[model samples]
Target: MSRVLVTGAASGLGEALAAAFEARGDEVLRTDVSYEGGVETGASAPSSTHGTFRLDITSDDDWAAALAHVEATWGGLDVLVNNAGVAGGGRLDVATMDEWQWITEINLFGAVRGTRTFVPMLKRQRSGRIVNTASLAGLVHPAGMASYNASKAAVVALTETTGHELAAYGVTAHVVCPSYFRTNLTSSMRGADTELAGVVSHLVESSPISAADIAAAVLEGLDRGDELIVPDQPARDAHGLKQSDRATYDLVMRAQAAKLEGAPRG
Candidate 1:
């Protein structure tokens, strides 16, 4: 069985992913930034997990401690799932620089810190997998989501580079670009006062799929050895449209942008 580590596991997709892996008999280290003070860093509490630790992805010390725990406890890790992120976006003219930094730090740099911390051990072992959770926004950029789009897109690029860079060491890297599904991700949404944020929240809340469904699809994708896994039909269709019919894609995107422009700002 694989020894897996998942960040942002307190709830939502990360929680579902940890459970999915554990259900398959893999030992999982479930972690979240919110799980602090009550549980010591690297210490497992009696939650629904093989182990649960408090890991603030923004902190390098947390990353170092996680690496140490894996080394001392599991000997090494087989899969590192960088799934921690926040939801935030606005128009280029509307989003503040600070808001962009906040989302980027957690959404993009969090994955980077996790990957950077674990690569040495994975390289030493000569076998490992890196799974990064991006978003459909990364692949198909919609209007008024420049910050979120850029962050997730960067994750896709990072995963691609990591895959190519570590291929010789038998390490595989994958990036999950899932469309919106029913999850608590919107709870962490920043700039809730904005119209764009409201639209994103509506889409997420109204999705037919659940976090478990996406988690299952992700596991299936991993089993199939997919490098870029777009786990939902709508996402696949959107991306396919973008590739096969750029003019149509442009029209659709521009239409959405036009709608956004016409709407009253919250």
Candidate 2:
């Protein structure tokens, strides 16, 4: 069984992923900012059993502690799932610099920090996987989601880069770009536009698939060695259309933009 570490594991997709790994008999370290009593930036622990820990993804010190924790407890980590992120978005003109930075810090740089902290260990072992949770917005940019789209797209690019750069060391990287699904991701939603935020929430709540379904698809995709995992059918269809039919893709995108133009700003 592989040793796995998952961020944002208290609920939603992260929780599902941690449970899935445990179900497969893998040793799992579940973490989230919601938990308390994280070790100081440089504390040492001899060992720990499979369980949860407090991990604030945006904190460098927390990441350092996490790396140390893994070394002490598991000896090595086989899978690192960077799944912690906040939801934020708005029209480019409406989104403030603060909003952009807040979302980018956790959504994109959070993954970057985790990968940076653990890559050396992965390289030394010559076998490990990095799984970043991006979004369908990363691949197919929709209107009124400028900041979120940019952040997730960067994650996709980062994963692609790592996938190529780490191949020589037998380390593989993957980015999951799932569309709207039942998740508590909206709980951390932040934006200047309330209407847009509600729209996002509705989409998330109304999705046909659940977090467990997405987690299962992610695991299957990892087993298949797919670098880009689009787990949901809606996302798959949208991406396929973007690839195979430029005109239709443009029309769909523009139609959404038109609706946004018609809606009252919050």
Best by TM-score: 1
> 46-140 in candidate 1: lDDT tens per residue?
43545788899999999998888888888999999999999998888778899899999999999999999999999999999999999999999
Local accuracy of candidate 2 as per-residue lDDT tens digits, 68-119: 9999878899999999998999987888999999999999999999999999
Residue ranges of candidate 2 with Cα displaced over 4 Å: 39-49
Candidate that scores best on lDDT: 1
Model 1, global lDDT: 0.91
User: lDDT of each prediction vs. the true structure?
Assistant: 0.91, 0.91
Per-model TM-score, in order, reads 0.96, 0.95
**Residue-level lDDT for 187 in candidate 2:** 91
Ten-residue stretch with the least lDDT total in model 1 = 38-47
Give lDDT for model 2.
Answer: 0.91
lDDT score, candidate 2, position 200: 95
RMSD to truth, every model: 2.0, 3.6
TM-score of 1: 0.96
